[model samples]
Target: MGLLGFFTRKPHERAGFELYSAAVGAARRPGFFAGLGVPDTLDGRFDLVSLHVALLIRRLRRDAAAEGPKLAQAVFDAMFADMDVNLREMGVGDLVVGKRVKRMWEAFHGRAAAYEAAIDAGDLAALEAALTRNIWRGEVVPEGAAARLASYAQALAERLAPQAMADFTRGRARFDVEVPA
Candidate 1:
């Protein structure tokens, strides 16, 4: 390591940021709003983003790569960093930014915990319940909407499970990249 190392981010940090950007892209897919009826409001968008990011972290943790945990932590940090930037961009006052970010951080963790637990258990019904609660705040979704979203999440997780760690370390988001390397 050298002084330049001090000035620039290490590869893992960049990879994490890239991966988080990918999650955001997945969350923004219009099907969620138009078909699935995701609220399209700020809170709704935030929940979707959190769901995708948690999925990535969960997938990363399942792999045996030596970098997996580091990458997962980096992904988590990148997400909150993004939240902080978004808050500032939205003109949130500096004095309350930390508090607001904290609340969001807690919210993400709670949702992530529910998501991870349900997925790990292979309990689609549990996942559906959690998704319904988080995405719609227990309001009735169009019939079968939660189930459909749960299926989508499960499919994405499976799609990601066998992905090469190389794509991730290279800062090529495995889930969202449009071109082959």
Candidate 2:
């Protein structure tokens, strides 16, 4: 088994694994990677990428516990941040990057649609299934796509990990205290 195998081996881990994998695969497309300014040595950063993925999972899990539409929005936001870094670092065209961003947007909307369907049908199992599927299975991007996405995710994860870890360790922070009347 390989490093990716660790991600694929556990069904429970598949959702988060595939989420980052899809972004990586998307960024690795010929025009995509070329447009993004990705170099040829992304594989060198695999370990760091793994750390980002772990952080992404942690963030997602934390956000999911919150009420309202924020959870989905946070997921979408994270995806965008990862995509932005890829495009910005690679010096890709705005048009190309925008197209890629739309693709990501659609993916999140699709996820929401699935979640809504499950909810409308009152099938919690379906929601769980949709949320857990390995969406990136059999997806192939250009040679370095996975690495690019992983690295991007890692960088973003690194940015968030300090705060994210604090949240994990200290539990959720309170923004407002109730006043006794």
Top candidate on lDDT is 1
In the range 126-165, model 1's lDDT, one tens digit per residue, is 9999999999986669777788888888777777788888
**Could you say which candidate leads in TM-score?**
1
Error of 2 at 88 (Å): 3.0
Model 1 alpha-carbon miss at residue 106, Å: 0.9
lDDT accuracy of residue 93 in candidate 1: 93
Candidate 1 lands at a TM-score of 0.91
Model 1 score (lDDT):
0.86
For candidate 2, give the lDDT.
0.42
TM per candidate: 0.91, 0.32
